[model samples]
Target: MASIARPALLRQVCNAAPTRRMASTFAGSSLKHPSPLTRRPMQSAFATPGASRVAAFHASGRRPILPPLPQVVDGDVNKPAPIPEPSASHGSYHWTFERLISAGLIPLTIAPFAAGSLNPLMDASLCALIIVHSHIGFQSNIIDYFPEKRIPLIRKGSFWLLRIGTVLLGISMYSFETNDVGITEAIKRIWHA
Candidate 1:
């Protein structure tokens, strides 16, 4: 009698609306929005900190991990090509400190000489200075992107310098040059030349 009642109870439970909905939507259906259980398992994928962390890495230009190539021979030393070390990577110079000082020094040293001679000749000199300084600063500044963990002051300061120093020099020089063409000179040039 107890065994007979078990089937009846099971049949009633199966016929229940809530149980049918649950089984149809969850137990059997392969196509559906992620359920809470599924989401719980993959929550990290949508997690605030996790998503932002991955995004920060992407913004910082970091590469995601992948497995190494399969080995063709044991201790062969030729299966996988060794990555070429960066040209400046193992060199003696501290890239960031060198970069920061150079970035500032190049412009600062130049702007004064340029300020002292704001003639048309200074125009060519200024252009040349911009090119040479830009090249040196750019090469050095890019090393800040490396993940080897150099000091922050070294990198960040140079980064700021790359952003602002060129513009500041331009502005200062413009004022100096404009002041050279004074009101009397301007009148004379307009009336005379």
Candidate 2:
């Protein structure tokens, strides 16, 4: 078959398309003819005038009159609020410490490999840093899954247990540093073995 030009095809398609118009009809008894209820006022003339429905409710000894609600967009109506978190004051400092410690770990890790061993002070410091980092990670996990509000005892107990474990591990690490190979050398031995 021969191909039709684009413009000619478009013209033929447009010409063949049916024109559609929408039609709407209303009932004879619609708003064009007013109802009896619309012709009369809803409330009595003797009812409280120049008063809101809520005010009228107050006048009738029903609801107590409350102060006007604060507007949504008014800055004063919505004052500068305190942070909603319970420990907001301490949170930023804690986060900064966590970040500083994480940064330190990069150097600490590289130093051990570069030096091929650790001095007693470096060994103990690295051990403490690792323990602290691990404790932070475990504590964060416990906080996420077991909220203090729901299980206060469990949360506190878990944190204390982590602290105890860290201390015990630190003692073991120190003992190894004095009596045997330190952390770096021990890792090297394991890998070589």
Candidate 3:
């Protein structure tokens, strides 16, 4: 589904039951408003201390899984606030990168058809874009599966491993383009054989 559709659905569901008569409209739907009985405190079902950890982790930026770090005993009430890291995936840079990849889909799909005719530069460009695209995708998966806060060593190691692999693959692609047929022509020849 397109990204815009999700927000539109949310809007519809949110505005659907503004009035009592409109509440009946959503009667048979899954997006019905909650009742008073279901308005209890959002507690974990297990009653274990760890059960609420996920909720707390999400509520605060810090992780609840690990023990808290010891604070400095020095009374420094005027201590400056720590600087926040610039977010790569939240602002304009993220949107531009996303759109560039989306636009490149056309070239990625069409270039393979005429692979034998494309120049080495074009082939190398396509290969680099594909590698970068794949790296971004894999990085996202890594971020989701192995967050740095939870597993610092594994996360950093995995990211560096991916970077090294991408560089090696890019070099190999360039060598292949220089020595023999580039990626598109090679794949085309494979299909013919």
- Put down candidate 2 lDDT per residue, 1-193, tens digits, no spaces: 1114445444423322211011114344234324323322333333424333334335354444653433346357657765666775468888999988888888878987898877777877787798889988998899897666566788899989988998898888778888987788888789889
Sort order, lDDT high to low = 3, 2, 1
For candidate 3, lDDT tens digit of each residue in 29-55? 434335322323332233324322334
Pairs of residues at least 3 apart in sequence or in different chains that clash in candidate 3: none
lDDT of candidate 3 at residue 179, scale 0 to 100: 96
Candidate 1 regions exceeding 4 Å error are: 1-124, 127-148, 181-193
What's model 3's lDDT at 12?
Answer: 38
Best by the lDDT measure? 3
Tens digits of per-residue lDDT for model 1 on 153-174?
Answer: 6566666776586677666556
Candidate 3 wrong stretches, greater than 4 Å:
1-84, 87-90, 114-117
Instruction: Select the stronger candidate by lDDT from 1 and 2.
Output: 2
Provide the lowest-lDDT 10-residue window in model 3.
Answer: 36-45
TM-score of each: 0.25, 0.52, 0.53
lDDT of 3: 0.65
The local distance difference test score of each candidate is: 0.48, 0.64, 0.65
TM-score: model 3 vs. ground truth: 0.53
